[model samples]
Target: MSTATAGFPLLTVTAALPAVGAVATAAVPAARRTAAKWLALLVSLGTLALAATVLLRFQPGGDRYQLTESHAWIADFGVRYELGVDGIGAALIGLTALLVPFVIGAAWHDADPAEGDAPTGRRWRPTQGFFALILAVEAMVVISFAATDVFLFYIFFEAMLIPMYFLIGGFGDRAHSAGEEEGAKQRSYAAVKFLLYNLAGGLIMLAAVVGLYVVTADQLGEGTFSLQAITEARASGELDMATGTERLLFLGFFFAFAVKAPLWPLHTWLPNAMGEATAPVAVLITAVVDKVGTFAMLRFCLGLFPGASGWATPVVIGLALVSILYGALLAVGQRDIKRLIAYASISHFGFIVLGIFAMTSQGQGGATLYMVFHGISTAALMLVAGFLISRRGSRLIADYGGVQKAAPVLAGTFLVGGLATLSLPGLAPFISEFLVLVGTFSRYPVAGIVATAGIILAALYVLLLYQRTMTGPLEKEEIKRLPDLRARELAVVAPLIAFLIFLGVFPKPLTDVVNPAVEHTLSDVRKTDPKPEHPVADKGWFDYTPGGDHE
Candidate 1:
């Protein structure tokens, strides 16, 4: 049986609830900003609960794309409002939900106005506008992941920029600036640069989406732009594009995802954005927002244009390797804690890109799981670094030394998070990274070996950062006086640490769900790239099991 059967619209409602909350938050008065925060929190928490419910109800080893809901919004134009998620999408949505509440809570006490004789003319307002902007982001990100329709996905994909633009330019930190004007100007430039790059990429994708529609309709007799319909037509050999058209469409989508992934040479905007945005905001930008790129590459580039994907794999793999080495080398040279995290993200994304292009079940599955693991690990490190920056009033690593003596809890937590970043054994990242390497090696042995070097470099950066910040003697008087984590702060961070341990020691359950979805995706891709001479005809690793689904 096909896994395309429609289920309840649970995922759709979950995606839409945040937008509803955004509207509600906007309705509140300016003087009652606290109420807006509470409302946004409640809304985000509700979305988390709904996501958990979906996780509980999700059936493993079944057909892909469960919890689907579709309604034809424009029959004449072949547009439909469709929503669904397989295990891969569900895993990412779960990560987004988990991060939203934490990001919101972390920003709770960040409001202060520097209208007085403060050293830094910084003003923090946890305003209704800010909370509403965050809610809008959560809404769009969830929708983007949940959207199965190409059109709806693109809409949510582009919609994300508005909130992020405002969050960085309007609500970000400007304390270290030469003056408020300069600070605000820097923030504005980062926001606009981000928007322009992403918008240009989106326009390219828009052309591709239209091209896809035209090709399908021309080939398949008044074709509908439905994902399932398109696939079915292709399966029946009723629809196929010219090689040139296919390659063009593939690039239209590829360029957009690469920019979002901020792969190698296109990664210029990330450092500036990370440096200027507030830490909590930076967490979402790096953790959830940037994932759109990699995920889209998997969903669009591979799913729709498998032949082109095969042709482009080597070029993309080379670029991924470059990002890995380049990002890590740059990270080691960073003085700012936040920019270091940003650079590390670029390196991690390179690893993810490698997994995607590996073109094996294990490689792809490992890549998907890496998305979840890295999101958690990166958020933890960034939040901890944010707290450290908050207390020290500086993000420069030189400003920190011997914090372990004064802030043991912070030191301990930072150590754990940092180790997790480097994929220490018995940690969540280790299992995922190992799977990626093993899988990549099965297909591309040389690239896999080089990728392993990236892992060694990861260890270097992570450990060096920890030793420099948390281990040395408390030389500065301020370092000796640095306060440990308060109970509330620990409350926010402890659960993330617990999850790391839980996911690390016992990853099978998550893997079980993940592997099957990956198997199904690989199976589909093989249908497009059939190998008749292979022992398993038109089958990838998904059909490798003896006397099972393949028969």
Candidate 2:
């Protein structure tokens, strides 16, 4: 599931070029905002091209991690500037590159006052700055995805908050607050919640990362803090820990990812953030940013603590099921479309968690694919919802009616996205959801059956939202004059629609790349534990349905 092609520093160029654009955009003058936006767009496009090249050149069935690069960054602290992509990371990095430019394009017209309008004050400057911040965030997120060294990953992981903080607090929806001034305050509150929760979780993870380093160093005598090295040392039985210490380390990592995954109970911050943040910012958060949690869980938790992960599967599955039912019920009662989507995301994340903890190859592979699919689906849903908000100046579902009669393209696109969210057949969500369900059924049939009802609830909520907003008579004066998606708006949404269908009907290409990594990971977990017998075939990958057969 890795590529071993030379002559292409594809990963670095794709991850860092957008950062360069962010810096360059900051240097541009207010009068030349168009130039800054174009520069950012071009940089994003270049990165996308690089990602595509990586995809094209990748050897899908070869190594487990490919296009790998490593160097010493902070040797005194045992941190290396190491980066690589297994199938999961590569797919996510590609998703980031694809989505960021669309996010920029989504807000490009809004970044400054539209043509023929003169900005009156600091508004234009801050708006433009938000675009730059988004680009910077995209850069940091891509780096996080590519990072393999624990310390380097943590740095990028936490550093992502700054740009996003400003993006929401400075340039989010003004309608959410009591007034324009209160809008900023609301955003600030959400930002603080996001920062505090993530920071607290991160500090815990930092202790665990350090704890891991110490354990490796103490046990192996000359260990470095490379993910590969730590993993190898653990596999070889060089580093050992008591059960209690392993559990503590697991919680440290678990709390951080759970918060980001916004797993139930720990998910209070997400609704507030979605309620106040701009659509573009919300897209980044839901689609790209939140993936960091699951990504890290897959990379560190499952990779580093396989036995602990396996042992703790039931508790995790229980939480995931709770999130599934709870999030859906909450979504049904929500008046705000954005908040509704936020809750829906929590539900979907529960499914991902379920898949991961299923401890089956199909479940793991489906979880990985679901991350990418959800990113696209959620972005599409949020952006279209944003378009509705911008035109009508409200996010309340009651505020919209007969939008289909008024805006056919918006209605149609929203329906497509909504159907995808509900995991309608022939769409991208269906395939991944089926895989997760099928995978989980192999281990926890009862939980899987209960969780399947979430799909039905999702259908109901999405349909109800769509019918209330788009299909009814244009009830309000504001809804009467709403416009269909403009050319600029189409630019923002078209790619997401394309990808939703692309991944739906033709996911095999991606699954081929990912299966090898999933296989490798499962093999390592079973190797380290060697109990409860896993399905390890001579093909070197485990099949999900079979029980107690490690060949």
Candidate 3:
């Protein structure tokens, strides 16, 4: 899975361009807010082009790590400015880049007054700052995906919380039912809670990281945070750790990722953060930024501590099952539209983690594909929902009724997004969800059976939300005047919908890229898909002799 570094630094540039653009956008004059928005959009498009180039250059059958760039930074501390992309990293980088322009377009006028005509105490200038912060987050997330160095990844991994905090607090959703003062307090609280929870997780991971370096130093005669170096040493039998130390270190890393993954008990921060932030930023939270956690579970946790991951599988599977059922139940009960999506996301993350730990090629490949498709599908649904809320000025499901009667196009687009979320056939998520279940069933049948019920629950929430909002009688005056999506908004939702259908029908492009990486991960964890207890192929149409050698 390891490969020599290539001379070009495409991954570095892909990550850095967004950071540089954040600075440039923030520097724009206050009056030129539109210019700043345009600049941000352009920079995002350029980054997307670079991502596409990386994807094109990647060979499905090539080295497990491709387009690599490594250089020494803190030589004494064994930290290097190392960068590379496996298939999962490449695919996720594409997902992050793909979502940002749509986010920018969706929030184009969000910096305007919350009420069309209400004077309120404003704490900050949002115009340039809002867009800049998003670009900064995109930068950090991109690096987090591509960083092959554990310390390098953790730096950006924890750093993304800063911009996200401001996005939640300073530029909250304008459609709040609460008074401005109360809303501000809520946003501030959500921001603080989000930061504190993730920061605590990061601190735990920091200790694990230091422990890793210490272990490597003791056995290899030099400390290193390089993922490639450590993994190679273990493979070649140059470094080995006692069972107790590996398991403890693995817990430290896994705990941090689980919190960031926002599994079950640690997921409380998500609803508040998404509820308070603008819709695009909500998508950023679940769709773009939060992916780093699950990605890390595959790249760092399994890659570095395979034995510990294996030992902890039963406990991890239990937690994932809880998240799936728990998140789905809460989502079904949600009255607020944004919180519903947030809860639903927690459910989906559970499926991704389940697949990764299922330890079959289909499972891990599906997990990687789930990350990409979820981002696209969530962006479509959430952005369209944002547009609907902006027009009617409410996030409560009860506030909306018979939206299709007034704005059929908007309702229709929303319907498609919801259906995709429910994993309806011919949508991208269905394929990934199916593979996860099939893979999980092969090894852990009982866990797979319990997980399958989550789909039924997903159907209930998505359809119920659509029915209540789009199909009921046109009750309120505000709902009646809701206009269809504008050209700009259509531009965002249409392509996402198209990708959903295209990828759903033909996911081979993604699966092709993801399978090799999945294989490498399975090798790292020393796992293989379970053989069937009964073989159907052995007893074909007429060959049903009970005593025959079926093996």
Candidate 4:
């Protein structure tokens, strides 16, 4: 369907505002680093305001892509600077916009030298560059979510790695007990690994994109990377290809998203990246950027290649189950708080993938909602963990004890975050996680049952982390003296916690918004659940009686 151009270019403006801010912030003099922070905040808030406008203007049960803006950029290749958002994309853009300002605030003092220490390395330098990189990443993330052109999406998708790489490698928090040299080396290793993994995926996807373009040109007499165009072609049977070729193309895209989702076997880079990067950057990676992987899986992989998606479902679902249990098991064993959170996200992401691949309306809707809920809950965990680590000058669980005695408010917030992670009832994640399981059960009962074990593992890890860190007696004088959650820290976490509760209590709005887009996506895939073999008897509920006559 062609885009409706009735309203303002809201999506474009929302995506571009951050880039503008990044340029403005980067132009500020190094001596005026404080001004840069303010500028970054202002820009981020402005973007957030624009994103809010998009959300407000968004019609919940409306078109698949709303407020779209399409202009020819590469006429020969049928490329356009196409931008728009379905409800899901709009919500994610809003989430990205919402988190950027807080991340800026959270990282405000990160670049400052520690007390009684002269600035010694790039890590101790001013933070203006960090803020600029964040804004840039935000812009790319917004565009990546909103882009309707596959090539444009790939550009934004690959482009995001640059700033994130710098954030992890250059400004990573050093382990408190490690020397500067050791920490720096670790950070570099993590950054390079992250880059290499994503680049490998991107390269494979690029080849797939080119192949898709060639196939489209051969069949339709034109090559295009427009998602709508390709989808239309596929629907019209003009984009037909051999089964092997189709599966290859689907695999190319799925492999990339799997790595980005950081699914089980491919998820090794995440813990290292999270363990090495600053908390704010880690928040961005885990909370916002990773959503792109699952989002693309639904949008591009399944949307473009339905038959291949169904063909690959069995293998994908098995891997997803492995991710769920394996990630949670690893999380249960982690001592580093950041790595624990990272592994938990892998487990959460496995649920998302399972839901998407389940090919049920409920599953896709839950997966989409899970993306937003995971963003909020994970941000809370990371921010709170960052606060604790900052005060204690350590990330090891063994380094903290009876922290609740010293910082009750902080401990309480952390516990709430932990509870959310474990999918406690009445929390946001529980709704989505439940929906995913129910949907998976309706289709793949065995995989669903196996994956449910991750919930027990989640509780084990989150509680263990809290118990060892917050519940014991205050033995270390240093631990006892740690300050409570400061105003800035509270400000960073309160909105996330409030969102978790608000969405938990009243998730209808988000689900309503997500359902239509998910339905549209599922319609494109054109897959349905297998029909039951037995006829149902006349009963209030589904009565599956063998040899029962139909009404």
Candidate 5:
């Protein structure tokens, strides 16, 4: 079970296929640029196929990581090349695989020349480099999710930033108001801001990793960075440390994840990055890349320092509430569509964090599933927004009017995505959002009640956006001639919409895959709900049980 049991090294191949495609795409001759695009698509589809295989092979109710591969690397330092996936990781990896091809397709014509530009004149083309960077990012993300060695995970985690930096800096759409020089400056500024924020967090976590290695060495007479080894040692009470030391180490890791999760006050960089990045890059960043932070929070922060996590719960829950309220308010007021989506993500992430800190199996399970649902729903919104921007030649909400008259399909798609964002009934996000609230309520009723207000705010923002952009009179000539969603666009969004409905109606399968992992994580953290101080009698004025009879 530890090694790739099948004939193929599935996880390694799945991760490496993208990199191989990147190299092949880059090696293609400049004259055959179209071939490079096809190559990237083929590679992405191939990776998706491999990911499906992993999913099919995955054991649904298993508590252990399956299809695992491990080998000794840096033996002197006790580092090993280890990769494995629990149910949670398997689902997210499947999400990553599913999204990349569509992202590639969405960007296919993104680099075309503007209207009235001379055909012979210099114009941007979707070059091999753009797709290569994307594939590179895919490889890194897959590796990060599959990695079981803390050091190995850190390596892939930091390595992920390089391609993403270029993707944001070089491939972003220039702001229309800003001249080329200013737009380039803005993109560069956002890219650097994103890089600096993540790098700071990564460095802090690196210190924690080194400290953990040293502590493990002191306790066991040999250092190790294997997640399984460290977790087992800590659980068995073989690796002990001072309370302060444990808290400090936990904070070191928490700081990085919180920044990446972009929880409230630390979330300033996200709006700028999302606003400046192209739609495909935005989808990747918001949908897949950002999940890394929360994933690491569940995988490392709680798993490695359960006591510290429990001790920090009150403060973490406070932060989560602030993020939920603050992000919603900002999103409601946003005029820029992209920045608005960015803020919405911050709000959704707040819910995810709240569930994680709720420290119950139900809450963690909901949080994990929320990560997947959010990716699907958000990707749809961003891509559709990109289409709208392309048509209107603007990103300002004020610039749109009567879009439904011009492109009914586009408007309808946006509405579907917006509805999903609001967690409307019969959509994928609703189930997870409901579970998070219920789980939180079961533990901290006051926080859960206050957080419920966010749902109302969500409906307001989504409907308001819809009303402003899609429901007005068709007065503008530019809007009158705009095209509806075309074949390619339909191809891109159809699966996402289908999934939103599919998961909404039938979430049991996904929850089944997620529950065991959630239970495992909760057990590792040793968290349980606090019992009520005063239990009410079943036949009395207040009955907490589901079916209490009143006299």
Candidate 6:
């Protein structure tokens, strides 16, 4: 029985609804910008409800990919419109839906017109277009997560950069250290750099995709870009590749994902992009858009080339270690709050990549959870910071002080965000970070020991960011008059903070969903959790067998 056999086109509707909403929102009259905003918000909420339905209907004990929909498209080329969700894909889909509404609310006025802003020039901030582009990006990302066909995944994977590019370049941050003209130039540079980097990666991936087709044609007497088809062929010993060919294919796929993941050397564009873009868009970049990359690593790089995946782990893990330490060290030195957060995200992504390559169930499972929790936590922190930056019209740490005195609620929320970033025990990120480190230690102890340094650096940066910005004497007049978060703003942030606390205490719901997928992925890579030298029971330390005495 095929996992992707005939079913209700639920997954297609889930993704397509937002894409349709984007078009509707974009068509609203310019004077009706407010209406456009409400429509986008409502669409995102609807998308969320649909995503929740997918989650509820998903059976963890069922087939690996469930609620799948497959249709014939480009049949001659063996390309089909196939969409499916395993636990990981479903969880990520939920994360995207969960965050988009908050992003919409926080960005309610982020794209509104400003003084000196040209009504008809490059400097114009089209309110409807901004919201529309966001919906558009969400639609692409949702489909990217749900896509099971290799070619189908790649199409949306590269297509998403279009809306994102416009979002970064067109609707830039109003608060710039430089003059408006200079900021505009900087925004252009960031947008171009972002596009060029990913485009270059996408082209390479395209070549690899072509190469994959050739391999299939020669070995199987047909060409197919179906993931299930290819994986089944490999498992049955009907398809084989030379070591060098498999390694090349793995590198090609991994490179594109790493760039999207924006690992280390390729990561230079993120800070500039995040700094120049509005806060919500920055969240969209790291929290939503970037997950596609790491998720692809799990889906394509490993799923298609398990042998080469093992061959490449050493180097991949090495790069991940560099990203962790390097991003943290740079973040500590950053003066701009948005850029600081950007660098911190790069560090967190490093940990995620490390866990994925750690090739253990705990590491992979933790990486999956990290994706979910980090999105919630970063959104909590970044959206609050955006609100603060908007009020003060500054992104500099030196420009803030005594914020706690006037806006105690705002300061408290900021504190929660900061603590969550540092992976404090009671926050959602701690569990994921702990599992990553444990998984790294189990397979790569020396790397794990070094990765601990990143945690210390995280604490330093988070606390210092808080100490400098949230506390101190009321020196600046703006800081003195800072207003507390309003009801609308509270609506944006409160739920995110609650999620951090709730998930921090109880991560079982997510773990239960994520672990099975991690096991499936481990099978693809032929890896297992390391057994403890001295076990109290038959199970290994990482085992999550339901807790009860067995007779």
User: How much lDDT does each candidate structure score?
Assistant: 0.82, 0.83, 0.90, 0.87, 0.88, 0.92
* Candidate 1, residue 364: how far the Cα is off, in Å: 0.5
lDDT of 6: 0.92
**TM-scores, all models, native as reference:** 0.92, 0.93, 0.96, 0.96, 0.95, 0.96
* Model 4, TM vs. native: 0.96
lDDT of 3 at 456: 99
Tell me the TM-score of model 3: 0.96
Off by over 4 Å in 5: 1-7, 112-126, 529-551
Tens digit of per-residue lDDT, candidate 6, span 131-249: 99999999999999999899999999999999999999998898998978899899999999999999999999998998999999999999999898899899888989889999998
Order by lDDT, highest first: 6, 3, 5, 4, 2, 1
On residues 1-551, what C-alpha lDDT tens digit does candidate 2 reach at each position? 13484556677888778888888888788788788888888888888888887777667777777888876787777888777888888888888989988888887755555343354444343455766787799889888888888888888888998887777666777555266667777788998998899899899999998888777777778646788887777778877766777877888899899998889889989998988887888999989999999988888888888778877888999999999989998999999999999999999999999988877788888999899899999999999998888888778888788999889999999999999999988889888899999888766668889999899889889999998998866777777788789998998888789889988989998898787777877776673111233445544654343333244
Question: In candidate 6, how many Å is residue 234 off?
Answer: 0.7
Model 4 per-residue lDDT tens digits across residues 230-306: 89888988788789999999999999999999887999999999999989889999998889999999889988888
Residue-wise C-alpha lDDT for candidate 1, range 300-352, written one tens digit per residue: 68778776787788899999989988888888888888889899899999989
Residue 129, candidate 4: C-alpha displacement in angstroms? 0.5
Clashing pairs in 3: none
Worst 10 residues of 1 by lDDT: 542-551
Error of 5 at 491 (Å): 0.4
Per-residue lDDT for 185-206 in model 3, tens only?
Answer: 9999999999999999999999
The CA root-mean-square deviation of candidate 1, after full C-alpha superposition on the true structure, stands at 4.4
lDDT by residue (434-460, candidate 5, tens digit) is 989987877777888989988999998
Which stretches of model 4 miss by more than 4 angstroms? Answer: 1-4, 116-124, 529-551
- In model 2, which range of ten residues has the least summed lDDT? 527-536
**lDDT of model 6, residue 70:** 78
The TM-score of predicted model 5 comes to 0.95
Best by lDDT: 6
